[model samples]
Structures are given as structure tokens and as C-alpha cells.
Target: MGALFFVKHKPTCREIDIVKLTIYTDYSLRVLLYLASKPDATATITEITEYYNISRNHLVKVVHNLGIHEFIITSRGKNGGIRLARPAEDILLSDVVRKTEPDMDLLECFNPKTDNCVISPTCRLKSMLYEGRSAFMAVLEKNTLADAAGPITQAKSGEAVYVNISRLKR
Candidate 1:
């Protein structure tokens, strides 16, 4: 074989410092971050869904949670939709992630003793993941919605503010 190389099917991951939270976590943040970038700005759920090309079904959950978590306010009117509840700078990135993440457990092993995997009783993996998690949260804590978002000025026609993995980079 010439220049043969076997690549392990490792899952591709985002290069951002924070560990992948979840699609729930991911979309929730995107909703807020998008609106935060447009503080004093608002968009309909349909608008956001169309701009992101994400299923409205999926975004509805995120938008609902944002409403429940007090991260955003929704208005029912032909001229209104959703807007950031507070100034973007006031919302901490860590806070949003904390509220959005399903569970804090970094690994399954953290749960009650199960699966006699030789090192289960003495493995430092759990603690290590914890430490890493803390560090990750601390990094995100340093940035606020404002930092994650761009300044909100005037909403221009044909102007889209939603951000995507491809639009932004690590």
C-alpha cells in the first residue's frame, strides 16, 4: 500500500473552548445570542427559523425555554415576536449555558457505582472531567451575551443577524 493511513472515525467537534453542551443547549444559546446581538431588536420565530434553516419545531423549544428562563420576552402581535429580556451585556454566557444544559454530569460513570470496570472505584477520570468542566464554564463565564453577540444598532431590511458555526470560527 502506498501512503496508507487508517483514520479513526473520531467525531468532529467544535473548536470553541466550551465542550458541546447539546442541541438543546446549542439552539437555546443561539436564540438568545442572536437576539442579544440585536438588543432593542426583535424577530419572529419564523424569521429566525428561516434564516437559520433550522426546523421551527426544534427552535420552538429553545424559544419557549428562553421565555421561561427569563432570557427573552415574546410578544403576540403582527409587529412583534421575541426580544432579549435584558441588555445583552447583563446576561452571562455561563449563566445561559447553565440554564440550557440538561445535566451537569460530564460522564456516565459519575452516576451511582455500576459496571465493574476495574477502575470504577478509583478512577480519577470523573474528577478530571469535573475540573475540565469547571475550567470550561469559567472560560464561558468570562464572556457575556454581549461578548458573544455583536452590537445592536438599527435593524436593516434584508439584514440577517443570526450566527452560524460557519459564519463564526474558533
Candidate 2:
């Protein structure tokens, strides 16, 4: 038999990070997409909660945070509802993610103040983790919310409808 050599393939940053988004972040994105799908129309908190079948209380916080970030415009009155503050194409996926994800630390050693890892002082792992996170964000930087929202199909009745929200989670 000929000599065989094994090759080691390192996992990508996305693979290494594999960070689970918080429910808050999930809701925030959902709300943004919902508004994006209906760019000309405003959606109320109740409408979004009903469409997604999520808790109103939780969505309230998400909506509030989105408004604070100026991602959406909220009016309070008879016509009160939320709409995108800017065009969908103007909203960068990276910006939403960075604002929503409170911590981007891939490992315990990533944060100097909170890191208790003894190996952190001389650890190459920290650098690797940072590289992974950077790689992950780099992908997000290339796309905007419009790329994610895609085309919203209008039904025969002229009502806007968007299917496959699962794609937006990415």
C-alpha cells in the first residue's frame, strides 16, 4: 500500500461559534422583516404578535428596542403602528445583529474583564475565536435586510403575504 497522509481541516468561525441567538434577537428580526414585507404599511404590535403567534409581552420589549435603535418608526394614535424608519435596503444585517446581540464573545476567554480562564494570558484560542467571530460578521456585512426580505408576493386580493420566515433567522 502507498503511504497515506491525513489532512486536518479546521472548523470555520460559524462552525466554531455556533452561537444561539437570544429570543429577543429572534423577535426583533421577525418584527423587522414583517415591517419590511409591508414597506408601505404599518403593523401594530398586536398584529405582529398574532402573525408570529408569540407572546405580546416579549414582543413589546423587542418592538421597543427596535424603535430605540431607530430601525422602525412608531406612531401612537389611531394610525399608530410601526414602519421601517428607512428603506429596507438601507438596513444592514450586520448592524441589526450587532445591536441585537449584546455579546459577541465566542469563548469565555474572549472578554478580558469577565474571563476567568487561566490560559487566557498566553492563549492562542482567544485569537482563533476572534477570527471566527470576525469571519461570521463578515458574511453579515455583505447583505442588507432587503436581501433577506426578498420579494413580498401580493395575493390576488392585493394583500401582501410573505411565507418562509425560517429563512430570515439566518
Candidate 3:
């Protein structure tokens, strides 16, 4: 009789799938972090671009989207700059991630209109991916912008706090 040994195989590249955050989302988060880090001062796109060494064209789009979403306020003309619409503690990480992420689909089956998977009708993978995505988002929900950006200074009694008035649109 001959002894048998077990053999293990590593997953091939074809078997592995990778997901990455878009540059838009990356820039959005970086902008948010920069603004949050300087709650008392406004930041300009040029300043942010220089600080991060990112492209002005791309940062402009990110800043515009942030303003449109009410995540950040923008002021034009002299002394014009950007600032967070709300306090860092008031911004939810999950909300930011959801708003910034271009797509949440983890697999082909996740989107019915574009799903071409043969197992679409009876795929356990979809359920597993949903579970995973939910778990991932749940973690973000537990945290706030302040958690990543650090605590904001508390205003003392009879002290004024900096507020971005441009973000007060109804």
C-alpha cells in the first residue's frame, strides 16, 4: 500500500475578483477629510489640490458634487473657499460612503437589468454578496466623520462657532 498526501491549490487570477473605489469617491472623501480637519477655516480647491497633489480638473468635479449634495458649502469671489455644510460629528460615514460610491453591486447578479449570469434564477452568491455588503455598510453606519477626522472643538458658553452660511439653502 502507498501513502497518499493531500494537495492544496491557490486560487488563480481568473477565480479572484477585485473591487476598487473610483477616483471620484476617493477625492470626495479626501475633500471631506480636509474640510473636517479644518472646521474653523475654509479650504480652496487650489489649496486642496496642492495639498493632495491631485488634478484640479478632477477635484473641481468632486467639489461641485459635494456642494450639490450639501456635504460642503462653496463661496465664490474673493475670500471664497469651501467648508463642511455640517459639523463633522453630524455627518454619518455610512451616508457619505453611500452618496459617494458610484455603484454598490458586488456581482453580475446584483443588477437584474445587466445580469447575464446563468445561475441568476437560483444563485446563492447574490445572497452571500448582499450579506457581505450589508455587513460592510453596517460598520460605516457605526461611525461618523468625526471618528476619522478627529473630534471637533466644543464651543464654550456665549462663544460663537463658525458656520458656513452658504450651505443653508432650503
Which candidate number maximizes TM-score?
2
What is the overall TM-score of model 2 with all chains considered together?
A: 0.79
TM-score of each: 0.74, 0.79, 0.78
**Residue-by-residue lDDT tens digits, candidate 1, 112-144:** 543334565687666776687688778778988
Model 2 pairs in collision:
none
Candidate 1 versus truth, CA RMSD in Å, comes to 8.8
lDDT of 3: 0.72
1-170 in candidate 2: lDDT tens per residue?
A: 11111112232332353356666677888888888878888899999998889999999888888999999988999989999999989998889888987777666566667777666678786787578668867877997887777756789999866654544443
lDDT of each: 0.67, 0.75, 0.72
Q: Which pairs clash in model 1?
A: none
Query: lDDT of candidate 2 vs native?
Result: 0.75
- Per-residue lDDT value at 12 in model 2: 33
Candidate 3 off by > 4 Å: 1-16, 151-170
lDDT of 3 by residue, 1-170 (tens): 01111112221222425545556777787788888777889989999999879999999998998998999999999999999999988888778767877667766567677677776678676787679778877877987777766433458785544442212344
Which predicted model would earn the best lDDT?
2
lDDT of 2 at 60: 88
